[model samples]
Every structure is written in C-alpha cells, then in structure tokens.
Target: MKKRILVVDDEEGLRLLYKEELEDEGWDVELAASGEESLDKLEKDSIDLVLLDIKMPGMDGVEVLRRVKEKWKDLPVILCTAYPHYKHDFGTWASDAYITKSSDLTELKQTIRDILGKKP
Candidate 1:
C-alpha cells in the first residue's frame, strides 16, 4: 500500500503545493488546514506520517504535536515550519524530524524517506 501522509498547515497554498509534490513522489497526501482538522483526520484515517506547521491561529503545532504524541505514540511526525528557531523548543523534540520550509522540497522529501525507511 502507498504511504499516506497528512499535511497540517494554515496556508492553503503550501498545503496544495505539498499535496501535489508528495503525490508525485508516490504518496497519498491528505491536507488539514487547522490543528483541529489535523486531529480529526488522524482519528479517521490510517495516516503513515504527518507534516506539521507551527504558528497557526487556533491551536499551535506544538500543542497539536503534544496531543498526537499522547494518542498516537508510534506515529511519526515531521515539523515543517518557516521558523527554524522552533527546533530549540522542547515540545518539538517529540517529533520524528524537524525541517525548515523551503520551495525546493528536496530536504523534506529526503527526511520523509529516511523516517519511513524507504529509498528515494
């Protein structure tokens, strides 16, 4: 089965872009515009991994990550954010990988493969 990836980001453009890019790399991409939606999807879907963003209006990514870790301890989560400083935050330590947002997506894809134990 194809790996299912849940992308949680407040920006619509980024979500769409990631969905398209990840889909091209043979992943089933699911998008959630907010932390609440992300949690909902996690409950309803068999997601293999999560690409999470910080600095949202409602619930921040760190809080969402905490909730996810509480419920789904084995699920791998990758923090993909514009702010690199969040890497220093203790809350982000629970995540499987932390990546800075970039248009190139090369690093992000590599991280995903590494965490999933798949060859690129």
Candidate 2:
C-alpha cells in the first residue's frame, strides 16, 4: 500500500502545495488546517507519517508533535517549518526528522522517503 502522509499547516496555500507535491511523489496525502484537525484526522485515519508546520495559530506543531509522540510513539513525524531555529529546540527532538521549509521541497521529499524507508 502507498504510504499515507498527514500534512498539518494553518496556511491553505502551503497545505495545498504540499498536497500536490507529495502526491506527485506517489504517496497518499491528507491535509489539516490546524493542530486539532490534524489530531482528529490521526484518530480517523491510518497515517504512515506526518509533515507538520510549526507556527500554527492555535496549537503549534511542537505541541502537536508532543501529543503525537505521547499517543503514537512509533508514528514518524517530520517538522517542516520556515523557522530554522526550532530545529535546535528540545521540543523538536522527538520528531523523526526536521526540515526547514523551502520552495524546493527536495529536502522534504527526501526526508519523508528516508524515514518511511526505515519503518516496517
């Protein structure tokens, strides 16, 4: 089966862009506009990985990562954000990988493949 990735971002444009880009990579993609929505999707779906944005309005990606790690310890989450500083934050340590946002998505796509490749 194709790997299903849940992308959580507050920005509609980014979410759509990621959906299109990730879909082109041949993986199933799901979108969530907020942390709560992402969490809800997680409960309802079988997601192989998460591509999360860190600067959301309500519950930021860090908190979402925390909750996801707490409940689904084996879930692979990649923290994708414009703010590179968060890569150093201890809160992001639990994530499977972290990639700074870029117009090029090469890094993001590769990271996703790397993480998924390691999973059963």
Candidate 3:
C-alpha cells in the first residue's frame, strides 16, 4: 500500500506544493494547517509519516513534535523548516529527521524514503 504522509504547514502555498509534489511521487498526502489540526488528523487518519513545519501561528512544531512523540512513539516525523537552528534545540531531537526547506525537494524526498526504508 502507498504510504500516507501528513504535511503540516501554516503556509497554504507550501502545503499545497508539498501535497502535489509528494503525491506525484506516489505518496498519499494529507494536509494540516496547524499543530492542533495535525493532532486531530493523526487521531482520525492512519498516517504513516509526518512532514512538519517548525514555525506556525500558535502551537509551534516543537510542541507538536513533543505531543506527537508522546502519543505515537514509533511514528516518524521529519522537521521541515526554514531555520536550521532548531536542529540544535533538544526538543527537535525527538523527530526522526530534520530538513531545512528548499525549492528542490530531492533531499526531502530522499529523507522520507530513508526513514520509510523504501527503495529509490
């Protein structure tokens, strides 16, 4: 079965771009505009992985990552952000991987494949 990936980001354009990009690569993509919504989706959907953005309006990605890990220990989350400094924050260590946002998704897609143990 195709893996289900939840793409969480406040920016509508970025969210849509990721959905389209990842979907084209054979992933079943779901979108969440906020941390709260992402948590709700996690409860309702059988999500295989999460591509989470760090900066948001309300509950930030770090808090969301904390809660996600607390509830789903085995769920793989990749911290996708513009700021690479968060990688130094201990809170981000709980995530399976950390990726800085880029126009080219090669690294992002490769990271996802690596975390999911899928062949290139």
Candidate 4:
C-alpha cells in the first residue's frame, strides 16, 4: 500500500505545492493548514508520516512535534523550517528528522527512507 503522509503548513501555496509534489512521488498526501487542523486530521484518520512545517500562525511545529511524540510515539514526523534554531529544538523533542525549508527533495526522501527502513 502507498504510504499516507500528512503535510501541515499554514501557507496555502506551500501546502498546495507539497500536496502536488509528494503526490507526484506516489505518496498519498493529505494537507492541514495549521497544527490544530493537523491534529484534527490525526484524530480522524491514521497517517504513516508527517511533513510538518514550523513557524505557522499558531501551534508551531515544535509544539505539534511534542504532542505527536506524546500521543503517537511510533509516528514518524519530519520537521521542515526556515530557521536555524529549530534544529536544536527538534533534537530536544526527539523528532524523526529536521529539514530546512530550502532542503533538497532528495534529502527529504532519503530521510523518509531512513525512518521507514525495515519496518514491518
């Protein structure tokens, strides 16, 4: 089965871009405009992974990452941000991986592979 990924970002353009990009790569992608919306989606459906963007209008990625780890320890969440400080924050939250918003698609895909590696 194709993996389902939830893409969370407040920017409409970026969210749509991700939905299109990841979908083209054969991932079943869902989008949420904010962390609250992302959490709502999570409550309604199961997602294999999360492509989360930091610096939203509210409920920043760090808070969402913390909550995701708290409620769903096994879920893999890759945080994308345009800030340098988030890398440090991600380490503290035990995030699966942290990618700068300018990150190359190849690296993002590789991180996903690494996280999803050997999973039954």
- Candidate 2 local Cα displacement, residue 21, angstroms: 0.9
lDDT of 2 by residue, 16-98 (tens): 99999999999999999999999999999999999999999999999999999999999999998888888789999999898
Total clashing pairs in model 2: 0
Superposed by TM-score, candidate 4 places the C-alpha of residue 24 at a distance from the truth, in angstroms, of: 1.5
TM-score of 2: 0.97
Candidate 1: residue 17 lDDT (0-100): 94
lDDT of each: 0.92, 0.94, 0.94, 0.84
lDDT, residue 40, model 2: 98
Error of 2 at 47 (Å): 0.4
Tell me, by TM-score, which candidate is best: 2
Q: Which regions in candidate 3 have their CA more than 4 angstroms from the true location?
A: 118-120
Q: After superposition, how far is residue 98 of candidate 4 from its true place, in Å?
A: 0.4
Across 1-120, the per-residue lDDT of candidate 3 in tens digits comes to: 888999999999999999999999899999999999999999999999999999999999999999999999999999999999998999999999999999999999999988877522
Off by over 4 Å in 2: none
Model 3 global lDDT (CA atoms, 0 to 1): 0.94
**Candidate 2: C-alpha lDDT:** 0.94
Stretches off by above 4 angstroms in model 4 are 90-92
Worst 10 residues of 4 by lDDT: 84-93
